[model samples]
Structure formats: C-alpha cells, structure tokens
Target: MSLATSIRRNLFVLVGLGGIALSAQGAAAQPLDSALAAAYVNNPTLNAQRAGTRATDENVSKALSGYRPTLNGGISAGFQATRIRTPGALTAYENLWPATFALTAAQTLFDGFITANSTEAAESQVRGSRETLRNTEQQVLLDGVTAYMNVIQAIALLDLQRQNLAALEQELRATRDRFNVGEVTRTDVAQAEARVADAQYGVSQAIANLSASRAVYRQVIGVEPGKLTFPASIERMLPSNVDRVISLGLSQHPAIKASQFAVDAALFQVKVAEGTLMPNLSLQGQLSQGYDSSISVESTGAAAVTLNLSVPIYQGGVEYANIRQSKELLSQARIEVDVNRDAIRAQAVQFWGAFEAAKSQIQAAQAAVAANTLALQGVREEWRVGQRTTTDVLNAQRDLTNSRSALVVAQRDRVVAAYSLVSTVGKLDAQSLRLKVRAYNPVTHYEQVRDSWAGLRTPDGQ
Candidate 1:
C-alpha cells in the first residue's frame, strides 16, 4: 500500500479504538440504586452520625442508675505515738496502732421527684438523639441524590458536545470542498473551522465538568458511580396535598422532634431543681472488720443499718437560680419546636412546588426535544439542497443539543424532587425504606443495659 493510504488506515483504526474505549468506560459506571445503597452503608459521615446516636443511648443508663443502690468500701491501718510531760519533769511516750474498715451501701428511699424526672429526661434525650441521626441520614441521602443527578447531567452534556463536534467536523469538510470547487467563500470555510474549534472546546469543558461531578458523587455515595439507567418516572413518588405534606413533615421531621425532647428534658431539670428544696431519705448499711496492733491489739467486726434524711437549707440562691434557668431553657425549647414546625412547613411548600414545576418542565423539554430534532433534520436537508446556509444548519443542531440536555436535566430534577419529598416526610430511615442492611435499634440496646447500675447487682435470692 502507498504510504499515504497506510497513514490514513492507521488513523481510522485509532479513531475506532478510541470510540470503543469511550463506550466501555461509560458502560463500566455503576447504577444509581447500587451507588445509593453503597453510600448508605459505607459513607463515613453517615456512620459517624450513627455512632453519635449509639452514644446517646448511654443516657438511659445514667437515668436508670438513679433508682439503684450505691455501694462503697474502704480500709485503713495506722500507728500513733503520744508523749506527756509534767512541767520540767521527765517525759513518757506511748505508741498505739489502729485499723478500721467499712463497707457502706445507700439506697434512695425517697426524693421529691428528682430521680423520676431525671429518668424521664434521659429517655427524652435518647429520643432526641435518634431523631437527630435520622435528620442527618436524610440530608446525606439528599446529597447523594443530587450528586447522582449531577453525574447524569454532566454525562448527557458531554454526549451532546461530542455529537456537536462530529457534526461540525463534517460541515467543515464539506465547506472546504465547496471552497476548493469555487462554490463557497474562504470566509465560509473559516467560519466552519471556528465552529469546529468551539465544539471541541465545548467537549473539553463538558469532560471537566463530568469529572468534577463524578468526584462529588464519590464523596456522597462512597464510590465511583458507573453508568446509570434512567427511571421511567418519578411522579408517583410525590405527595398529594401541600397541607398534608406540611403536616406530615411537622410531625415526623427530626429537628422538631429533637427540640421537643429538649423541652421535655428542660422540664425535667426544673423538677430536679425543685427536688433540692425538699428532704431526701435514704437507707444505709455498713459492715466492716479490721485488726489493731496498739492497746486493743485485736480484730474487730461491726454491722449496722440506719435511715438518713438530708434537707437542703440554703445555698446562697443557687437553687432558685437553677430553677429559673431551667424554666427559661424550657421556654426556649418550646419556641424552637414551633420555629422548626414553621420552617418545615415552608420547606414542604417550596419543594412540593418545585416538584410540580419539574414535572411540567420534563413534559415541555421532551416535546422540545422532538420538535428540535425535526427542525434540525429540515435545516440539514435545506443546506444539502443549497436552500439554506451552513449557519442555519449549525444553529438548528445547537438548539437540538440544548433541548436534549434540558430534557435530561428536567428528568433528573423530577426524580430528585421525589426523593426530597420522601425525605421531608421523615420516612427516610433504612428500616422504613426496607433497605438491605440491619437497622440500628437504639431502644433495644438501651433496654438491655438500662437497669444494670454501676454499683448495683442482682440479689442472692434471685
């Protein structure tokens, strides 16, 4: 073969291989559902939030400890010497050793609502923690959806840019041939070349955007996303009414629930503070055995049981201040709950409206894509027949590409909105969604450890 023909054949082979590689790379991308699931399981931020929730369950143990008895033990042995003198006379010295040991147990028999209120507060705190974790999970889920949609959008834009580049190359070639035949001006060829360059630049920019978007997707979903199949529709996932949507959000939103728990805890603080003004009764017992090497020089054992009462006299207004501070905190918590409810309602309205508008945009974009496709075909045919200029065909092609990209964006928006609405309703927990992983159950673990106090144990009879 001639050297020129050999060069041309090698160029064709390279182009073919490049196309195959691009196709394979696109195909290797993971599906969106799988990416989301992976994110749920592996995302470090979400796992950290889960750990925080588990830590909150420790409050249950703290609360239950108030109901249990406290036991303490101590032992001591010592020797002492004493010297006695009469005026200026000689002095006499004596040494003595003593040992003492005590084992003490105290059980709260009665306190003016302190222990009860504290336990209630701890329970509320646990609830609050779970809700906060749920809120964090929902936010993470939304971020994942956004990242996924962004990747899809960038990919679609990249495809459009590539197609435009190909079309522009073909047009440039045709214009060059026409110029050689003296049918088209040099200016026309230059314009075609400029368009091709611009299209190539567009392709480069799209690729950059796709890369950045993929990084974000990996950050949220905990893995590199692969090719994704578009959903058929997302309208079915949207809520029906704005009022109902707001109501559901207010009832289930984690922030609001957490605030409610805060209020409960604050109220409990007030009770605990009030309990300081009343007497506390406790049952106490002690048993001990010790040896002394002094005058007695013997082992001693003692057992005794006693009832004790402690009354708070005054603490320079500290108790009153605590009560006032707790009351103020309770008031702030109540206000926060209301504020959260209002904010959630407003967000529901906004997202629901966006979802509805996105549905319309999808329909309109789909129609636009169809119309622009036909328009581009007509413009291409007119140019071929010498009835239209190259500019006209190029313009139609650009419009068609834009319309297709818009359609993909609209489709993604619709799906994201659907997910947002679901998240707003607070049913976004893994168990509620029937996710594959085992849901973390804080209550079960709390129950298991709550009654086991630090110093309390089961009785011998049991």
Candidate 2:
C-alpha cells in the first residue's frame, strides 16, 4: 500500500478504538445488580435496624431469669477495736482482725403471676423487634428501587436530548445553506440555533438529575451502583388484585404485627402489675465462713436455708395505678393495629391504581413518540422544499422531545409503582424475593442467651 493510505487506515483504526473505549466507560458507569446487592447488604440504615433487633434479644434472657435461681458471692476483710472502762477502775482494750466470705442463692417458688407474665411480655417484645427490623429492610429496598429507576429515567432523557440536539444542528446547517441561496430567511437559522442550545441545556439538567439520584441510591443501598440491567416487562411484576394485596399486607406487614405484639406485651404488663397486689414466696440458701483472732484462732463456718414471703399491703396504690395505665396503653396499641391496617389498605389501593395508570401512560407516550417522529420527518421534508416555516419545524421538534421524555418517565413510573405495590403488600423481604443473601435469624441468638442464668449457678444448684 502507498504510505499515505497506510497512515489514513491507521488513523481510522485509532478513532474506532477510541470510540469503543468511550462506550465501555459509559457502560461501566451504569448501575448494576451486584451494586444493588452490595447496597442491600451494607446499607447503614438496614444495619442499624439489625443491631436494634439484636439488642432486643437480650429481653429473652431478662424474662427467662425469673424462672431461674440467682446466686451471689462476696468476700470482705477488716480490723476492729473495742474498749471498756469503769470509773476509777482499770480499763480494758482489745484489737482484732476479721475476715469473712459468703455465698447465697434464692429461687422464686411463687410470685402470683408476675414472673410468668413478665417473661411472656419480654418474649412478645423480642418478636416485635424482629418485625420492626423486617419492616426497615422493606423500606430500604423500596428506596433503592426508587433511586435506581430515577437514574435510569434520567439517563434515557439525556440520551433523547442529545439526539434532539444532533437533529437541530443538522437543520441549522441546512437553513444556513438555504439562506445563502436567498431561499430562507436568517430567522430560520436563528431559531434552529436556539433549539439546539435548549436541547443542550436539557442534557445538562438530565445529567445533574442522574447524579443526584445515584447519590440517593448509594445512601440507601450502602454502595456505589455498578452497571444495571432492569426487567424489560415491569407490568408483569405486579399482582392483579387489590383485595389479595390488602389481605397479605394486613397479615404480614411488620408494623401491624408489631402493634399486635405491643398489645400482647401490654396485657402481660397488666398481669404483672396485678400480680404485685398479691404475695410472693421464695426459697433462699446461704453458706458463710468467718475468722476473728479475738474470738478464736480458727475459722468458723455456717450454712442456712430460709423461706420468705412478701405480701404487698399498700404502696400508695402504685400497683393498681400501674395496672390501669397498662390497660390504657393496651387500648392504644389496639388502636394502632387498626390504624396500621387501614393505612396499609389505602396504600395498597393507591399503589395498584398508580401501577395501572403508569401502564396506560406508557402506551400513550409510546404512541405519541411514533406520531411525533413521523410528523417531524414530514415537516423537515416540507422545510427542504420551502413549504414549511421555521416555527413549524421547531414546534415539531419540541413535540418529539416531549414525547420521548414522557415515555421515559412513564416507563420508570410503571416499574416504581410495581415495586411499591409489592412493598405495600409486605412481601419485600429477601425470602419473599428469594434474594441470594443469608437471612438474618433472630431466634438462634435469643435461645442462646435466654437460659444462660441457669449456667451461672453453682454445680450443686445454689
């Protein structure tokens, strides 16, 4: 080959490789599934909720301790001096060193219903905490989905704006050529230039929006988003019946379950308070050894056992007042359960309606895009033939741009609405979605610690 041709071919190859590199960079910047999964695992809000749930696991131990014996031990060493004096008689003084040690245990034999009811209440609290954590997870997931959809929509709109700008640039060049030939006015070229500038501005705004959305996505999911691939058919992801959704939400929604658990816990509290008005019986045992030089050179040891009963006569009516307060709190909890149920039902209906509306809007926007594209093409042809004014061409371009933007928005809204509906029905958990993360188990920790007090006692069951 000639030297000039070889250089030209090399330059073309370099340009092609550069274009590919740019394309790859753009693709790498897109949010992906792995990013979302990482975000799901590492999000701080979700982690905090998990920590809160773990903290409640301690309640199980606190409750179970009531059924177990408590053992305590202590040791002390001290010095003492005593003196005796009589008027006009000889005085006597003595100094002695003493050491003492003891171990004691007590077991509750009966406490009316306080211990049992209190333990039950703690168990209910643990369950409530678990449900609250699950609810937090659902909220985080929904936020992640919303931010993801927003970024995708913004990217789509930015792409549309770029295409619009390219078309306007071409029209500007054409209008300038026609004006040079004295066929079109300078106003045509000026309008085309203004449209191109407007499209560029839209692209800038879209980019800014995408950045903001990505920040929110990162905030919720706890990691930077990688290249993302969304489901092609978002409508198919939605459930059909609002009634079924409401039923599921009422049954499984964490807020509703938590409220119910609160009521149960409050009922137990009332029982515990009423138990305080009765009598408590406990068995206590102790073993001790002491040494005193003044009394003996050797140590003395003693063992004792006792039964104790505590009968409450009066404490300013505090116990009764507490029971009354618990009853009122229980009533509030019941009301909360009702409120949560109604709220879930309303949210389900709204999300279902939104999903359907977004679907319809998508179809309408798609048709508008097609119609606008054809109309713009017709106007361009007419302009070439000096049959269409500059304003008509500009109007058609604006319409086309609007249709494209609307279509992107509608597509995003449909996906978000579908996810919202799923969330409203309380089925947004990892198990429900079959997500590939280890499910958090609250029971194992609770079981590990609940009976720990039994192990704290001496081998002889002190």
lDDT of 1 by residue, 119-156 (tens): 88888888888888788888887788789778777777
RMSD of each: 7.3, 7.4
Cα error, candidate 1, residue 29 (Å): 7.5
TM-score of each: 0.85, 0.87
Which of the numbered candidates is closest to the native, going by highest TM-score?
Answer: 2
Clashes of 2: 9
lDDT by residue (1-462, candidate 2, tens digit) is 554554344333321221222112455644334444665688898888877776787777777777888899989989889787999999888777888899999999999877889889988999999888888888888788787777666656676777778878887888788889999888878888898898889889877987887788778777655655554343454566888878888887888998899889988988988888889999999999988845446688999999999998999988888989989988998899999999999998999888889889978876676677678778877878888998899899899788877877877788788888878877777776666777777777677666665465422244
Task: List the global CA lDDT of all models.
Answer: 0.77, 0.77
- Candidate 2, superposed: residue stretches over 4 Å from native: 1-36, 84-90, 232-237, 293-300, 454-462
Instruction: List pairs with backbone clashes in candidate 1.
Output: 29-226, 29-227, 30-226
Q: Which clashing pairs does model 2 show?
A: 30-226, 30-227, 31-226, 31-227, 31-228, 32-226, 32-227, 32-228, 39-221
